[model samples]
Target: MAAAASPDRAHRLLVVAMDFDFYRQAHSDLTYADIDPAGHYGAAGWREGRDPAPWFSTDAYLEQNPDVAQAGVNPFVHYLRSGYREGRAISRSQFADAYYAALANGDVPITAAERSAAAEHFDARFYQTMNPDLAKVGIDPLDHFLRHGWREGRDPSFEFSVADYLELNPDVSASGVHPFVHYVMTGRHERRPLKLDLTFRQAALGRLQSFEGRLADARRWARPIELTQLGVLAEALANAPARGLHLTFSHDDYSRSVGGSQLCVQREAAEFARLGVNHLHVFPANGWPTVRSGATRTPMGVLLNGETVGSFVPHDITRALKSYHAEGPRSFAIHQMLGHSSRDVVDIVRAAGMNAGYFWLHDMGSLCAGVHLMRNDVESCGAPPPQSAACGVCIYGAARSGQLREHELLFSRLDLTVIAPSQVALDTWREGSDFGAREALVLPHATLVPSDEPPPMRDGPLRIAFPGTPSIHKGWPVFNHLANRFAADPRYEFFHLASKPATGTTARHHHVAVTVDQPLAMRQAMIDLSIDVALVWSLWLETFCFVAYEAAAAGAAVVTSPESGNVAAFAADSGHGLVLRDEQALEALFESGEILQLSRSVRRPGLFDLKFSRLAAELAPA
Candidate 1:
């Protein structure tokens, strides 16, 4: 009889257990069920079923036994008994909470099922406290159950039982433990209880509620696989067998320390060494450049031909003080701020199997399909996901090229094989990339255009010509400076051949003659513009600087930047004309005898042949 009731029920259960007739003897005028009308002793209050609490307090029992209370053992479990009374219906879901809560609170010796459940539920300290019966038999509770198997309902093998094992290793055993109590706990003769543990669905539904579905910000839980909250992770980790998930802080969005947890550093690397996490890759978004309107630096000291010219802090935006940074044609932030999703772009190489070339990547960044721009669904390419095709050079393709640049260049995936037109372009790509460690190649889009048609002879001192749009990149400011300086000199004559007509100050400028020679044919343009020295001055990498080649082929002594890629390199190789360091050097040349000599000697060494084989080779395998 278990101590499962108040004074009245406890006494009644005791009498029934000792002598079923005893309860009837005391109440001979009544039957057993009537004596205890609640049926606590029959089927209501019992270990196999529901049970009632003691009708009275266990204070008197505690008073009689101080040791039981001092030991922190439940007096009801020790003094009275279970299986003596009945109460309301009990459920596993209801009991699981109570069971864990009770285990958390203290130890108890209630029943075999309760003890076994506790053995599987609580930690080592709690188990050692509750299972003294197993310990006295000198059997490890954990090893015994795992090896010999728990009482999950089969024949109980006495040979493998902890008591038998101790008997074999007698030096380890002194058995005074109650055999009948052990048999009840372990189950009838080895037939273990198979259904004590709940089913997966049962356990899942009967689970302790987790911290999921507690919505947070977009940045808080962007990862689809791993959890973000630390406390939840720690809780999950503590009960490793119950749940399959572990915690992680492996997002690229954080490079510096988030809280005290160091990200993208060795501190976290060493910590994750022992953790269950496998991936912690870095994203370009984490270390995105701090793009600003102004330059990162101002001119510390202006110089010409390596000589110190001047230095000053800028008080305002003026011609004398210039921004050291390059300004983009337009802002791309409008899309993000306005929440306009970028369009999609198809990969030209992957689609057509073409070897990427100059502006190939730039073109792929766009959705240009023949004439109309295409749209990116952003579903085809796998991640790190491809950005919208709408991000590109606005001067050329707007979002088509710009978004593609961000997706393919800035934060591009590793799979893309980027190609270049020349060494100059490759150099530029390398300088501007955190990529190139993977797929990068040097292949030029060039052709040999033989110089055959010679230009008609022109009458002038040294007819120097510079042709291009009035752009900062075209060295327009330097050209204008030269025009002003040589305006009064009759010995020097210059032509500013523009891609289009200049309307403002150029028409009336006193020095160089300005004209819009938009000719339908290159040969005709060369013949009409009987220019001598061709100024192919530009500030950009200029891919191949075909302008320099065209001018050179048109029989003009070309003066160009020494660092302007293939054009400068070719000039050096062919001994074409002058490859200078600065604009100041150009001034000296225009005022020198070499200018006249080079002018007369410049010839149209035509070199133009379509080089499509480079593309073919690029598309081929290693």
Candidate 2:
């Protein structure tokens, strides 16, 4: 055999071939070679093939070729014979030659004969080695073998037959049959086990634990192993070990428990310390906490021009600060900060012993809170307030005032980096603020990444989706008016979350009435309904509306008010849809049939895929 150089890099290469040593022997200048064949060929096949082999006659090929050794018996040939007994005579030589070529060219080929042979060998091996009990169930060794390879072992296609296999293995129980049968038949694992350490505190446990039960339920319906815990529950998730350790703690989910006066057990923190696990997620709730050392004040009034304006801090501020101190995580996330709070919190958290800083832009303060600025009932900034009282009309008035200044100061003070949910938010923040502009990263919002086999798109009466808790601030009145206008169109249908049909009349707008209490089910229903477009008509400032993300993930266009801040950014970049400035824009869209055009274009990848990877990249140990 010969040693051959890699085509691209001249790096040494290793080649392994069964029964066809002559082909490789001819190319002995190759890096390395391992040739052998088992089954019927035996020693006779090797002896006969090498007797007058090409390389045996060519000293040049042999001299240049690296040392060659025959490895294990060829299982592939044995596999072909198994199928041959059933009248399936596939050409072993043709298959072997093709495979040899592919492997030489740095490609791996799974031919029908090889797949059959490997599958059968797997069945016999599973029964002979791993689980002999499987053989007792009249399971056809071949079918069982195929299922084992398809499920636990990867092959391809999800289409398989449990019943056909069961006919062969009669003793296999139906109960055991489900998981393994699912593996073979659907080419999917029965369940994805998520590992969780039991020693975690109740608060931390509660957040991570909730995912465990849901993941369990998800596995029951789908052929995927969903969630698994790490450390303590490692054995439970042994079947699905690819998902590594590291528990997640969103700031919003655990803030109340950690920051409140109760001081619940910090089980997660203790577990990390005990296990020596450095990976910790400090996702905050609402907004990141901003601290002012040496001074403590409650609800201090904010002033722009020496005038007693609105208050700068809310009650949630105190709660957020408390949680930061209690958790003492290795990594901290400034949930809703633009850049100002990132610096402020980094300084405070570092002083408190936390070292790494990571920020997720849940809203506009990090960018331009003035995104909520409006004039003459339209979105406008620096156009002068309609009135002194109207100045307070901006939902994020105090936060937007000195955003650039705050961000500039924050960027320099921080050691790590910051992320925004949308490219718009990142661009806006970078352009408007000087702080860490170069360092700012764009991590979009998390949404359900649509599967390759998406649910069928539904068609019927126009199914308009409006998701949000009913409040005057969310423009429920505007939605109501639009619903009423199209109610008689017969083709129009309406779905609303946290809202109801107007009292006493069978109005055209059908209120679906979803609530936050059942967030999971509500979200699922939204996806199932396949709503054409989600109308986010918020009149107030929204950091980043998760509803629009969810809707877009379900392949629905989003029609939101431009004043909705970051939501408009989603509409612009993803080609999912647009932010309607007023009723006129809505009317024009409806009349010109552009709404349908946008609806058809709503295949934007979910924000979750974009943002999660970006956040992971930024926060990942670097």
Give me the candidate number with maximum lDDT.
Answer: 2
lDDT to native, each model: 0.37, 0.42
| TM-scores for every predicted model | 0.34, 0.41
lDDT of 1 by residue, 375-395 (tens): 121111211112334323112
Model 1 misplacement above 4 A: 1-343, 346-414, 436-439, 503-523, 601-622
Q: Compared with the true structure, what per-residue lDDT tens digits does model 2 show for residues 450-508?
A: 45644435545556777755444456656665554454455566667544444311123
Provide the RMSD of all predictions against the true structure, rounded to 1 decimal. 36.1, 24.5
Worst 10 residues of 1 by lDDT: 330-339
Error of 2 at 515 (Å): 11
Among all windows of 10 consecutive residues in model 2, the one with the lowest summed lDDT is 258-267
